[model samples]
Target: MTDHLILRPSGEFAGPVDEHTLVLGIETSCDETAAALVLGGYDVASSVVSTQVDIHAQYGGVVPEIASRAHLDMLNPIIARAIVEAGVPDSRIDAIACTIGPGLIGALLVGVSAAKSLALAWDVPFIGVHHHEAHLYAAFLEDPTLEFPLVVLLVSGGHTMLIEMQDHGRYKLLGRTIDDAAGEAFDKVARFLGLGYPGGPAIDREAVHGNPEAIHFPRAMMHEGLDVSFSGLKTSVMNHVRKHPDVSSEDVAASFQAAVVDVLVTKARRAAQQVGAKGLVLAGGVAANSLLREQFLDACVVDGIHGFLPSREMCTDNAAMIAAAGWHRLRSDGPTSLDCGAFPNLKIPGLT
Candidate 1:
C-alpha cells in the first residue's frame, strides 16, 4: 500500500503546528452536477449542487445520455459558484478533488475532465475520490467524534455497501448488495408502483399513510451474514403487486419500504456487532430515507453503539463530502499525479 501522509517542512518552533489544506471538489458522476470547497478537515466552506431531476422526472428515472449532456451544461458554472461562495481564488486551493468512478461513464468524464483541466491550469495536485469513500467521510463532517474501526453503511442509488473504516483513508469492504443497489431498487419499485422519479424520497414520502405490516414481504439474507441482497426482494414486491390487482398502492409502498429497512438495518447492526465497531455511520442518497434513518437510529440506540449520520443535504451526491475527503487525503499525501484521469470503476485501493 502506498503512503498517504505527507511531511511538512519543519517549523522554527518545535511541536506540531496546524496545517490547513483547502480542496476544491467536483462531482458529476450522476444526475447532479456538484462543486464544493472544504477547509482543513470538516468545514464546508461552500457547496453547490445542480439537480437535473426536472428533466429526468418525466422519464421516472435518470437517462444516462441525457444526464451526461446536462452535466456538461451545468458543471462549469456550478464550480465557479462554489469557488465564489467560498470566497477563495483558485490559487489558494491546495488540491483538486473529483469523483472518478462507479457512476455513469459519460457523467464521470465531465467532472474528471474539468478537474484535470483545473489542476493543470492552477498547477495543483489532483486527487481522485471514491464515490463511496466520500459517503463515509460525510460522517466526519457532521460528527467529528466518530472514531476508526467503525462500520459504515452506504446506501445509495448505485451502491449499497458495508465498509470497515480502519483509519483515515483506509477501508475494508465487508459486504455489499448482490444485485440492485438499495436506492436503485427503490427507484424501480417506485416506478413499478407508478410513483414519480427519484424513487427513494418519493416512495419514502408516500409510505407514511400505509401500514408497514399490511403486507408480509420477504427479507433476504436476514438470518445470514452481513452481505445483503435486495433484487430478489424487489422481485417479490413486484410479484405481490401482480397478485393483488385491487390492493392499494400505499400498502404496497409501505410494505416494500418495511422489507427494505428490515434487511438494511438488520444487516448493518449485524456488521457492527460482528466487528465490535465503536461507531456506526450511515451515508448516501438512500440514507436520506426517513424510515431507514429512523429504524437504523433506533437499532443503534438499542444496541448501545454510537450512530453517525450526515445532514440531509449531505446524504446525496455532493461535492462537499468529496472536498472533505480530499482535504484529509491532501494532508496525508500532497495529492494524486496531475495526470490522473477518470476511473469509472475506481476501487478503494486494497479495500476489498
Candidate 2:
C-alpha cells in the first residue's frame, strides 16, 4: 500500500501508450456519488451520477455526514453501472482516479478509499485528482484542441478564483473571493428569498421572467482587480427583502443574478486582457448558470477572445472530469503514491 507506481513505462496505464487508456473515476466530493469511464482523456464511455439533491433539498444544503453515508451506500453500484454501461470488463480499466481534496472530508474519503481499493484490486495505477483543477479540465474534455494561455474563472459553492493556465497542469491564481464565494452567496440569498435548496438553479429560473434592472443590486469589486466579493451583495438582498416585504421575488432573483454575472464577466474579461490569453473559460458548478453562460459568451464575443464551456453535466461535480484530469496527470507526472491522503481543503496549484 505504500508503493507509488509510475505510468511512464506502463503498458495499459495512463500515458502515451501504444493504445488508448481507460480510466475509472470516482467522485463523492459532496452530495453526488458519481463514477465514470473516460477513454483517452476526451472520450467518455459512460458517466453515472447518483445525486442526493432530493435528500439534501429538505435542509437547503448538503450535510456532510449524510452525503458521506449516501456515497458509501451508492458508490459501489454507481461504479458497477459505469463499467456495465461502458461495456468494459473490470480488468480492462487502465487506471483508477478519484477526487481527493477541496471538499467535505467524509465525502472525499469515500471516493478516495474506493479508488485506492480498486487500483489495488485491478493492479492498475491510482491517480488522486484535485477537485477544482478537475473542473478546469472539464472544458478540455469537451474540446481537446483548446490552446494554452487561458484565463479561467472557477466559480462554485465553495470557491471563486481566476487562474491563468500557461499549459496543461500549469496554473497561476490571479484572484479569489475574500469572503463568501458566488455559489454560497447564491444559496444564502435564495434561501432568504424562499427559493428552496440549490439556489443557483432556483434564482436562475426565477430571473428569466423578471427584469434584471429592477433592483440594480451592487456589483462588489467590479474594479478591484480579479478578486470578487459577494457577501455584501447577499446581505443587501436580505435587507432589501426585509424592508420591502412586498417586493417581487422574481425581481429580487433577477437583480441578484445580474449583479453576480456582471462582476464575474467583467473581472474575467479583464484578466483575459491582462494575460493576453488566447481563450477564456468559465468552470466549476456556478458556471452552469444560464445568465452567466450567456453573458459570458456575449462578453467573449465583444472582447474578441475564444470562449470555452462544457456541457451542464460537466460543469457541475462529476467523475468524468476527474478521469480526464487524471489521465493528463498520469501522462505528465506519472502516478500518485498509494499513501496519499484525502485533503478537504486542497487548494489548486498556484493558489493566491
Candidate 1 at 172: error in angstroms? 1.1
Candidate 2, clashing residue pairs? Answer: none
Where does candidate 1 clash, by residue pair? 4-332, 5-332, 6-332
Candidate 1 positional error at 34, Å: 0.6
lDDT of 2 by residue, 87-126 (tens): 9888889989899887899999989988989998878888
Clashes of 2: 0
Q: Over 4 Å off in model 2, which ranges?
A: 1-19, 350-352
User: In model 2, what is the error at residue 32, expressed in angstroms?
Assistant: 0.9
Which prediction has the highest TM-score against the true structure? 2
Q: Which ten residues in a row are the worst by lDDT in model 2? A: 1-10
* Cα lDDT computed for each candidate against the true fold: 0.84, 0.88
Model 2: lDDT to the true structure: 0.88
